[model samples]
Target chain A: GQQVQQSPASLVLQEGENAELQCNFSSTATRLQWFYQRPGGSLVSLLSNPSGTKHTGRLTSTTVTKERRGSLHISSSQITDSGTYLCAMSNNNAPRFGAGTKLSVKP
Target chain B: ETAVFQTPNYHVTQVGNEVSFNCKQTLGHDTMYWYKQDSKKLLKIMFSYNNKQLIVNETVPRRFSPQSSDKAHLNLRIKSVEPEDSAVYLCASSPDWGSQNTLYFGAGTRLSVL
Candidate 1:
């Protein structure tokens, strides 16, 4: 079974600040995805990066498959950016998610 | 815009009650999955159907079952719900069963068992 671990269980930032979240897996990952979930809301896929780096809006996802690790960076965070950021990895079966990083942006 | 749609955004029932959740994906994906998110926000995979065929069935309780009539629809049924069953059930779909595919998730159904 693959295990995904996310760092900084909780993070707080002021508006316009940058945030970085880390994810590490215990096994080789064939796919990696970053998701955002607002309070009591559905999970929204942010980025899918199996290897190398990917960017969407103010978000950036970088994955090093060989290292079994990935990262999500949020730039110029806003109050609406407050939510839980989840990282999931999969090898050959269903994806496994980490505990998720709770982000709180203060206005 | 969400391509995956789930019915009954929320459900409330007592223990031993039977409950069902419906999920449909307009993305025309060949694989669908059900995941449970607990109060602590820990997400766990429960079942996955590929082309309407059961592919990944985690070590969940036997009372939990997944039904799929086609590649675009996947449903979950709980014969005897327990207090522990109170959680958010998310339905997701991917292009295929391949690990490299990205998953699109529905809004999810929040279950409350009393």
Candidate 2:
């Protein structure tokens, strides 16, 4: 009963390239959050876009609440940006997570 | 710059042993949570507390319990360690239970059970 699903379990790209990650949920989400997890590290919140679109630095997050879907775009990817991107959504109090998309940026 | 603090970056113990992990947040958040990340990279919420009151308790084992003395601190205690319990435990907090706030996470404590 996974509520959140992320596509392309893993991704690889050259430096300076752009990457697009998708997140789909089974039900309406009142809150959507994107997180980044480095190897053997913790998760850092990247974006918290429940609806519409939002941007921060080279990252962009768009969520369609009605459609129960969200997307995270990473522009000009760098080697340091290599990590696992996780998408979480909450309809109420507790948040649910997807398997995540692991991104590797090669220089 | 460390808003959320988790002690014992790594811990190793034998099966049947008891373990406790501590978490504290300085962001003055009203809600705190405990999440577990398995080796397969699956993150799941275990429990959540708001204002020192238990809010959300997922279908975790009864051996796992969340203890909170205040809104700023949330601790996790396991009565008996098991091999399946070896994973990274993350602590997170948000300003409140409202949808307007984003969660801030700690570095996590990696546990290894033999």
Candidate 3:
């Protein structure tokens, strides 16, 4: 079965630090999306970077389609950024999601 | 603007009880889907509806069924739920079936079966 794996299962960082989360998939995909889930909150679409690099606010995503890997980069992290980051890839039929990387930013 | 919305943010019930989760999308998408996130936070696809028609079944158990009143609404109903069914259910919608389109997700319903 095809699977998406997220790295570091958990991450803890200090305020103003940087964090990077990696996502690797074993299937061929043309589209990949990154999402953020706050504690007891809804999942928010962060970036849909199928390939190359994309930046939005404090977050940046880089995806290498050939390598079947994607990474989410958070710069100068803040307490509010504490949450779970999920990675998903769209196959021909359905989209598969990773277990997600839990992030905890401290003050 | 929130394109997707789910009702009953939290639910608690016992085994053998029947429960239904409703999802609505204002994105005017042609495809809607239901996903389950287990305790380990592994999100898995259960059902998919495209233009009010079932497209993907994923060998889902008969106890779990997805119903759509219209293109904008897709609901999931479970009969005789079990403890293993306790998980977060997510509703999502996309403009089309193509990979070029991104999905919009709802807050999700957290279910706990005792």
Candidate 4:
């Protein structure tokens, strides 16, 4: 069983559209973080939300620990934002990662 | 803006050969980790160290080992590589070893085993 699960394995959208990504954990998560990875590039941290909603620029993340789920909302998407979005959770001292949502934004 | 650094952006070797990858963090973090991403792009944690002490070791093969000389450096070594070992090895670091901390990752080292 996967400890972390992400919805919409892949998404394609036009520029300026809004995109929503979901993450669900099978167990209790003490921390949650969202990351973005361009093709053949390193993972970049987007947001770290433990339990509440946090915002940064065009990205907004909301995590509800009690439900073991988190979401990343991207507003006004751009072609540069086209990449894989991964959500990771921490349970105890171990880290669990989701399969990730591959998003493509067309200009 | 790159805090985590990894050596040998790419490596291709034959099976049964030894391979090593290096990782360093300049963020003054106390916790570092090594993750493996397979061809399917599935990422999984292999080892984690906090202040040069092993904290987590996943069910990896015996040939795989992680070495950390200090809090800033953590290295991965495979005694005898296999075809299944071909994957992107990523290195990460966090300021502390807690559930609430965020991890910074390095440009992964792509390994290809023949």
Models 1 onward score TM values of 0.98, 0.97, 0.96, 0.98
- Against the native complex, each candidate's DockQ, computed on alpha carbons, is 0.89, 0.79, 0.75, 0.81
Ranking by lDDT: 1, 4, 2, 3
Each model's lDDT comes to 0.95, 0.93, 0.91, 0.94
Q: Write the per-residue lDDT of candidate 1 for residues A1-107, one digit (tens) a residue.
A: 78999998999999999999999999999989999999989999899978999999999999999999999999999999999999999998889999999999998
Chain B TM-score for the candidates in order: 0.98, 0.98, 0.97, 0.99
Ten-residue stretch with the least lDDT total in model 4 chain B: B94-103
Flag regions of model 1 displaced more than 4 Å.
none
- lDDT tens digits, residue span B1-114, model 3: 787999989999999999999999998899999999887878899988989999988877899999998999999999999999999999999898877768788989999999
Compose the digit string of candidate 1's lDDT tens values, residues B1-114. Answer: 999999989999999999999999999899999999999999999999999999999999999999999999999999999999999999999998887768899999999999
Report the lDDT of model 4 for residue B50.
93
The clash numbers for all candidates, in the given order, read: 0, 0, 0, 0
Candidate 1 displacement at residue A62 in angstroms: 1.0
lDDT of 4 at A89: 95
lDDT of 4 by residue, B1-114 (tens): 999999989999999999999999999999999999997778999999999999999999999999999999999999999999999999999988887669999999999999
Better of 3 and 4 by lDDT: 4
- Model 2 residue B30 CA deviation (Å) reads 0.3
**Candidate order, DockQ descending:** 1, 4, 2, 3
